[model samples]
Target: MSEVASEVIREMKREFKVVGKSVPRRDGIGHVTGKTVYVDDISFPGMLHLKMVRSPIHHGIIRNVDFSEAEKVPGFVRVLTHRDVPKNIYTILCLIGVGPDEEPVLAVDRVLYKGEPIAAIVAETEEAAMEAVSRVKLDLEELPAVFDVEEALKPDAPILKPWGTNYFIYEGHHCRRVRFGDVEKGFAQADYIIEEVYNTSPIEHAPTETTACVAKPEPDGRYTVYTNTQALFFTMDNTALILQVPFSKLHFVGGTVGGGFGGKVDVITEPIATLAAMKTGRPVKFKYTREEEMRVSSTRSAWRMYFKDGVMKDGRIIARKVISYADSGAYNRHTPYAVTKHAANIAGPYTIPNVYIDAYCVYTNRQPASAMRGFGVTPASFAVECQMDKIAETIGMDPWEIRFINAYRNGDMRPHQKVVEDATLIEVMKAAAELVGHKLPEHLLKMHSWDREKA
Candidate 1:
């Protein structure tokens, strides 16, 4: 280990006793013993089951929510249509201090994505509630759906959320752009220029447990919910707003999460469960199957990035420019922040003197994306790292040597003009190379051997 890293480690060890030790988890015993009181395991007296009636169309205008036929179903207690929901439009992410761009509670007047909730059914029996949903027909007028980000960006594309010029919630130019030194001049001084485009697709966390929420209405016209949520406090606040009740009336208890790699952060099943309970005046439990969870819940946004790099004959990186476009499916859940972060991280750890990057979040008719593991860094890393390899090839230099010459160090200024603090990229690179016993290519090695003999 480096002296600095060792010192930091020593300091951390001094500050904390269990820092290096593998201490047993607090919930480990119950988890292994099967004694943990998970929400799905909890059953309440007179608790009713709930089921949602989701939109089958990708994009459509909700002409009507007819729940009259469902009221005749045996064991059916209460039904909640879009009209029954509050006017306040909010998302689970916004409620928890993520970002704005929430949709109307329940698909009000319009459904932007397939599997979006249009109405919910509540009943005495779980089977009855499931059957009751089929009776609650949603009359929807299909609108032109945008399945692709490129298509959505087209001038003639039907705007999903018409607030901005396009369907997306544009965070203005400041969020879309990044600049450093004069990129044009840097490229002009370069001996070689290379560019490549990288594509990434949406992926789900796919936790073993699907989304589930149980809500019980209190006598004081409030509801308490137990569900799988990463941000409990945020869910409570948003649920209260959606229910049109005081904050005190809504209580949230995050269950022992089976798993949520940023997927459970959104308020997917909670609002539906709360709505069902409130309407029925009885406790309601809603559990989503794997298929339903994947269909309706958000996932990581897909990214397409084009990287252009200018390199000197000696393999020194001079400039870099990246243009990234993110497919923010359906609602503007957290695309602005996602796109901004993607743009900021385009230059990676390379020490390019000039850099320019643009990231766009275009709306599409699919599940809205939220934060995922690694956030926007993975795509940016892949593009820049691959480009770095290409630059090495053109200059006939060792890839490691090229990286060592251009990799940013602590206190180095990045393309965004942000000074990096305590960066260990060089140390990490060398250590990794040494550990792997990296060797030069055959051609380079042969050339070097010939040069040595000549010398």
Candidate 2:
């Protein structure tokens, strides 16, 4: 072996403590014995249970809100509307320079999706909270609703977003766009062009533990919050910002989570519970039931991706254009960022010479989408990988052969003009072919990441 390769292996071995060895997991025993202190496992004294009064309409203008019946419910402590929230509006990604916090923690003048939180009730018991939440009356004027992004983008379609547009603005651009090289010329020079569209519906996180939080008022004036949030500091910052309180005033006592999978990334239940605790001077606990978790919680945005590719008979992708829409449901939770990521990665792990992409985070009359395992990139990969088979079928080439032919190599330019370095696509594909015993033509079998395909 070459000295450099040998040194790399040595370095890799040094970096790993459990490689090729039967090392026991550190936390497996504790989990198996039921000793983990998940957020749901905790309890406090005099804690008020909370529930939300959600919107029933997909899109509507709120004419009136009545809590008279809710107030009469036994053990009903308080009901908070959008008016009660100090800073009613916040985007979950605002800390990362994502601007114009469009989503209200509570529905303000309008409801854009079914099951959107319009009011929160805090009571002495869970039943009381549920009863109070159910009794809160809303007078909503129904509006024309669109579920599809294409439909939502039509000139005559009803706008679901508060910004008067159905889509998120990315640095003044209507969609997250990426362009590089001469795509028109590449398409003109291609032997065959393939256009394909792929779609994925809203995916739920469906963790063992649904969204939950507990907020406790402390004697020192700093509120203690326990939640299963994926990002603690982000949640803390968002909660503090939404409540219009200093960040230091909120103390986060969390790290244990049942399962998040990026669904817990949003600052959902914590802010409301904290506000309720501050108002009532008592600990507030809020937990979404299985139904609420499935209905109201953010899911992976449904994506509709269109790909137009310029390819040679030999399987090299010369040019590509990806137009995709992430159905952001009613609000911009993390979907705008997901759009940017989709724009960046839509073309997948390929080194195309010419590329153009437009990714939109669109509002629709559905449950808002936040984050999941891969967030935006998984669906992109799904579309591209599925297209690989389509491309092979179109040109009568091997599926794996096509991947190796178009896979990224060292110093190959990407869609954004970033030259790929140390790419492993060719090697990984080669290994997969070997493992699966996929037979490739002799010429195609010789391809390598370090060298161009001569087949």
Candidate 3:
């Protein structure tokens, strides 16, 4: 190994005590022994089970919702509709200044997508809740639904939002945009222009323990919510806002999660369950069935990315213009923020002189998309790496050489204008090549992240 490589290893070892070492997982034993208590495992005495009555049609105006049959069901306690929610309109990102409260706690007036919750049926038993939910009568006027991201943007497209646009407005712009240098000039100077479109489907988190919460009304008029939410504080605050109560009136108990994978971050169950508990003066437990978990929960947004790259014969990428559309589905969950992150990263780690990105968080008549593992950046990385391979094929150069030529070094400016610091892509790539038995030439091997002169 070179001296620099040895020094890097020494530095890593010095900075990270756990690096290259195995430590026993703190929760491993409890998990294996079935001693771990998930939110669904806990129940309160005289607790009411909550089941959602959802929309069957993808797009529709709810002409009427009759819960008389549901109320007639044995063990049915009460049905909570949008009217019952103190402040029904809520957006999970409201805490971060991201919305005008787009999502309804229980959908009002109309249902935007199939499986959108219209009413919460609380009953003495889970079976009773399910039966009551099934018995609720809905009269809906079906509307033409647009599922494609591009189709939703057309002038004739069914406008999903009240502001009269299918896409999120970014400070008066139609999309989140980033411009570094003059992309047109770079393309004019290039030998080749490689253009391709990439598409991705929404992915469900499908955690072993589905989205669940148990809300109990305290004797002191406060509410205690036991949930599997990954964002405990966020859920509490949002729930308080939805309930129109002081933040101090809510106590969120969490920390044990079967699996989140970014799905549990959305404030879905806590507010409504707590409201149900408050109205009935009894604890309310809301849990998604396996099918409900798969069908109704928020997912990683589907993406359509168009990449047009200006490349040199020697394999340096001079400019990249990326137009990306993220299907945020019926509501804005975390996708508005995700699109901003996507705009910053869609160009990847390469240091192109000129880069342009326009990322849109679009509304469609599908289930709302939210956070998953690396919601904004993972899809971009996939597209970028694939585009890199395409560029290598077009220029007749080694993929490794192409990457090393364009890899951003420390002190480089990202397209978002953030100063790159502590970048390790080049070094990590070198080590990865060796581990995979791919022999890189000396020129590529000598490249380091710290100094551009070495390249």
Top model number, lDDT: 3
Error at 128, model 3, angstroms: 0.4
Question: Sorted by lDDT, highest first, which candidate order results?
Answer: 3, 2, 1
What lDDT does model 1 reach? Answer: 0.77
lDDT of 3 by residue, 240-326 (tens): 999999999989999999899999999999999999999999999999999989998999999999999999998889999999999
Residue 164's lDDT in candidate 1: 49
Winner on TM-score between 2 and 3 is 3
Model 2: runs farther than 4 Å from truth? 1-16, 19-22, 439-445, 451-455
For all candidates in order, the CA lDDT equals 0.77, 0.89, 0.94
Give residue 450's error in model 1 in angstroms: 36
Q: What is candidate 2's lDDT per residue for 1-455, written digit by digit as tens?
A: 35998899999988888885678878778799999777778789898999999999898999999999999999999988888999999888889989798889999889888999999999999999999888888899999899999999999999766578989988888999998888899999999899999999998988888889899999999999988888899999999999999999999988778888888898899999999999999999999999988998999999999999999987888999889999998888989888888888888898888999989998889989999988899999999999989999999988877887788888777887778888888777767777899766777567777767543
**Span of 10 residues, lowest total lDDT, candidate 3:** 446-455
Q: Which residue runs of candidate 1 sit more than 4 Å off their true CA positions?
A: 2-16, 91-102, 167-171, 219-222, 439-455
Residue lDDT tens for model 1, 1-455: 56998999988887886878788899999999999877788678999987788889999998887788888989998877667776447755554354454586677788888888777778898888878888887788999988877787788898776564443444445238888898889889989888888888898888888878899888877778998887787777777767777888887887589888888877667876887776777788988878887887788889888888888887778888888888778876666667777877888877788998778877788888777876677777877788878878878987877876676766678877788776666667656766899754443333211111222
